[model samples]
Target: MVGSSVEGLTFDENCQVLSVTAPAGASGLPVMVWFHGGAYVTGSGESTKYDASLLALEGVVVVSVSYRLGIFGYLRDNLGLLDQLVALRWVRDNIAAFGGDPSNVTAFGQSAGADSVYALMLVSDEPLFHRAILQSAPLGARGPERAEMTAALREFVSVDASTSVDDVLAVQKDALSMASARFSPSGGMPFGPVLGEIDLAPAASRIELLVGHTADDASPYVPDQPEAWEIATELVFAGPARQLAADWTTAGGQAATFDFRWRPANAPLGACHCMELPFLFDPAGWSHAGMLAGQEPDPVLAKTVRSLWTGFARNGMAALPSRSLELGE
Candidate 1:
């Protein structure tokens, strides 16, 4: 870990900025700011799953952050968005010290992290990022409402939902205080981002973007629940899913979409969520040999995807496709 700090930010004493850089001789590396996903309720920059050292070796400076997750960072008390914005500000001002080109930063995330990427684009009109990659999360999806969230909190705290708003606020304050007393700073459930009021600003158009979902995105989240899987499939692919597709297109955005329905013939399970992660990271040399399903990870596919990502960070166009991943052309 390279020791560093950014200025013009006030973190809740426990929070600190972390920076990771490529080895020496690696010059002019692109920077990727990665955000982890755990339904906005869990997850951190320290997950073993996201090792940026590999990407750093690929000539990219990777900065994985430890933002307040759940209630601590997402309490929505008017300061929530400000807190996230400050983190981006830190990246903007200080990433250059670690050999990162701040101007060419791409924000990447999966699931709730992807949700944050979408929210950041919509809320931050100043546009701190040059490109964004949202995996397994589409924009404009319905999440929890504030009132519903409050009621859930009330139930968790064993308080009556019918209590006055001010009383409910008191309960929340006390609950947060008690939570702090018992657990370390890391223990907190993040309430997801809000839309209209706190994030009332329109989406940023200048940044290049890559947004898509896995063929079985919700698989990992609810594995072994067959009925749940069917419901999610309908929801994500057929039902409101089309609206999300239309929303992406209507935004005048350049995006590449893929449906990875490649399931192993022997495995009882279908294409479930998070199946794309290993493929995207191309772990276990699967990209070279292909998966058991005979679904090869085409270099053309990898190049097509990574080129769009890197090219977007370099220049804000998804770029002309060099090859096709889907059969339709």
Candidate 2:
């Protein structure tokens, strides 16, 4: 693993490591910092799902950051988001050693990670990165209801700080089950950056942006509930993504948007939540992902996506998806 794999429940010195990959002989290149998503509870920046080597080959430097998650991260505060802030500051001060341009950093992520980037935009007092690329962020994840947080807290109150990490995870799993059962169409995650709990700083209205969602981003999660899928796809992803771009532009910031409509041929899931990831990362890294269905992403589409992403990091603008689909028949 490029960074320390936090795969198992046990913690080690390498748990919160950050990994960097730079092009051969790279210097003064644009840098991209990636935050992986597992609903704020289940991912590691070191996961193979986020291998950035292929993206680095597109003539840029890529850094993947690992942050705290779940009860350890958001049980009482925005600790995960704070951890990311620390990583950004580290990049600002030290990325040059990796042949990257510290001033041209772009903070990018998918799903919950994308939400973290958005939260950072509001809370960061100083500009940590020059640009941001938010992929499928649940911008519509409404929150801070006293009742919901209180209910969530009750689950944690029984957990002792001295409990083993693995035991704590079991408790988290139980809590997640309860939370999932209580989830409604009105978008809000059980564990994520809560609005009222986080003090809102100045808006990062000036940062350039590249934002969008898969055409059918909510399909996979609501495979059995079509109505829920429709509502979640639009309310939780598509509608808010478009609104974020519009608001960015309205705030006098440069922004680019895309609608990824490509899914594997005959993929029942359609272009769901993470459909575009293989195109941005190395398909090999996502080989075991159920969403891909053992299919290889079109290499041409992958190249196009990589180009668009790196182009944005280098110059803050990349051509939007020209057609409804970037791949598939």
Give the best candidate by TM-score: 2
- Candidate 1 local lDDT, 55-89, one digit each (tens): 56556777876676545455554243455677778
CA error at residue 309 for candidate 2, angstroms: 0.5
TM-score of each: 0.68, 0.88
**Candidate No. with top lDDT:** 2
Off by over 4 Å in 2: 1-14, 143-147, 154-156, 185-188, 197-202, 226-228, 318-329
* lDDT for position 193 in model 2: 62
The collision pairs in model 1 are: 70-189, 70-190, 71-189, 216-272, 216-273, 217-273, 219-273
The residue pairs that clash in candidate 2, if any, are none
Candidate 1 segments whose C-alpha is farther than 4 A from its true place: 1-16, 78-83, 138-147, 150-190, 197-204, 225-231, 234-242, 262-269, 280-308, 320-329
lDDT of 2: 0.76
- For model 1, the local distance difference test gives 0.55
Q: lDDT scores for all predictions? A: 0.55, 0.76
